[model samples]
Target: MDTKKPYLAIILIQSIYAGMFLLSKAAFDGGMNSFVFVFYRQAAATIFLVPLALFVEWKSLPPLSFVTFCKVFLLSLFGITLSLDINGVALVYTSATLGAATTNCLPVITFFLALLLGMEALRLKTSAGIAKLTGILTCMAGVLTLAFFKGPHFKLFCLHHSHTADTAAASSSLTWVKGCFLMLTSVTFWALWLVLQGPVLKSYPSKLLFTALQCFLTSFQSFGIAIALVRDPYEWRLGWNVRLVAVAYCGVVVTGVTYYLQSWVIEKKGPVFLAMSTPLNLVFTMLCSAFLLCEFTSLGSVVGGLLLIIGLYSVLWGKTKEQRLLNEKCVSTGVNKQGTELTVVTT
Candidate 1:
């Protein structure tokens, strides 16, 4: 695929995430618990991806080794199951706008974790990396300021009687706090998944095959929990409404298509280019949240969102510069070698 294609696909992925937020809200409203909703999404994704995987990667299916299976299994649990579980529940407690803003910090966490693990190198001499890190820090400051600082009350719609203005006003405003924390914790798991999956992706180059295995393994992993928790399997009836349709779209397009695109793009362009596109998702998701779900954006949200974008780009800038310098050095060496070869040949 072309370099610009992944950038375009990421837009689609962000839109799917935005749709997921809404469908999840519908699932919550339709008497489905968090675990139930998560179970459904995973089940749907697994079903959708299974056939697609068989069709696309039939010949390329790798021999499922013990080590590779373990990696994929862990990735499925952490990345797909746990990450989405926390995020889906967190969205229930928090507004979509806040969720979008908070999730933008994902890349910053990823960068630091990668650095600590020595998967990513830090060059203090490279101003780009420093600037990028600085930007990430600055964005963190903005998120903190937005989260902790004072802000006026904004009203949307009241869902339940307990969510009425009078009740909401009287209750301690900490659920959102807890929700954000959960989402952040989820981000940590996801970042770890990405770092760990790097090696697995390198070993198994077929994204479709890997994704299919991961999803199938994760479904079985969650199946045990689903059966243990829900007494009646009849409760797992598929709701083929618009909401379920949205969920299906996310499963097929986001998990299946977008994910494969991301893997291919990363393999082609490297992680730096891929990570840089993180902030764009925030923008796209925020816009979709506003229009699709009628989400209200606060001033703090706007400011915090901007800061997150700044920080995300800073990291990208640093990595891009580092790569550029490395390429220049390679070119210089190649030119020197070519000149010496010509000189020796002529003599």
Candidate 2:
């Protein structure tokens, strides 16, 4: 049971995200403003996280320096605020399934960014390197396929609403392409956030506090963006509706609970294991969107999704093999050094 905990935790996290995609899409379909939704979601997350962070980390909290606070602020701005705001608009233009499918590109994008930042190296001579390169190419191919192709649409066994037809009418080819690129941009920022978190965490060293601080700062940032873009005071109002539910679920469950669970899972099973399960999110989102949202799945989407999954695994495999090789080399070098020292001491 203990051994299965991480798997269960990750599955739960994916399930939460699947619900987020569906709920967010539904809310947007009902004409909820994306910017306002971002603000409310972040505010909700802050409300939930602040007290919990205080309770769990208050006694042992280290004094936060201004520099670290600024870092966290910037992180929140680009990572959560921008990524989510853009993603909401993208979801408005595209289907929840596309949003989920595009997320599979994150690992590949992160790897590419790492290479550019000199944080990772590629050895063309090695099979691992070849796999990584192939994966990158495959992921791009998948993205292109998704963006350009919408083959025959097939409906699942679900209620077909007039709203679905209206949405399809509004989604022109240009809008679909724009949404695809927007989704890509959102994932890029998210990947950047993942890469930058390492150094910030080293400086702050408190996971709970760091996450809470980001959410807190993001709420204010998103609020500013929301108010600037959406001046209609009426748009800010949240009644007893799907908008409210989406905000609450995204803020509390997706942001708050998932963060805690993900941290635990990463600690126990490592990030690679967690990343490998991302395809499960696509699967869940696809099914839920079909049944609940009455969304159509195109042949191109299925084919592209398959390609993206293939790319994700290929990259993960290469990364894992590279790490294993590096560890083995270190062990071999240590053994050789120890033997040499013993020989010299005996002499």
Residue pairs with backbone overlap in model 2:
none
Candidate 1 lDDT for residue 329? 100
Across residues 35-142, which tens digit of lDDT does each residue of candidate 1 receive?
Answer: 666666677788988898889788877776788777788888988788877877776766656666666677778788888999888767669768767966886786
Error (Å) of candidate 1 at residue 63 is 1.7
**Each model's C-alpha lDDT?**
0.70, 0.91
**Evaluated with TM-score, which candidate comes out highest?**
2
* TM-score for each predicted model, relative to the true structure: 0.84, 0.96
Off by over 4 Å in 1: 1-10, 153-171, 229-243, 260-277, 287-294
Off by over 4 Å in 2: 159-162
> Over the stretch 238-257, how does candidate 2's per-residue lDDT look in tens digits?
89999999999999999878
How does model 2 fare in lDDT?
Answer: 0.91
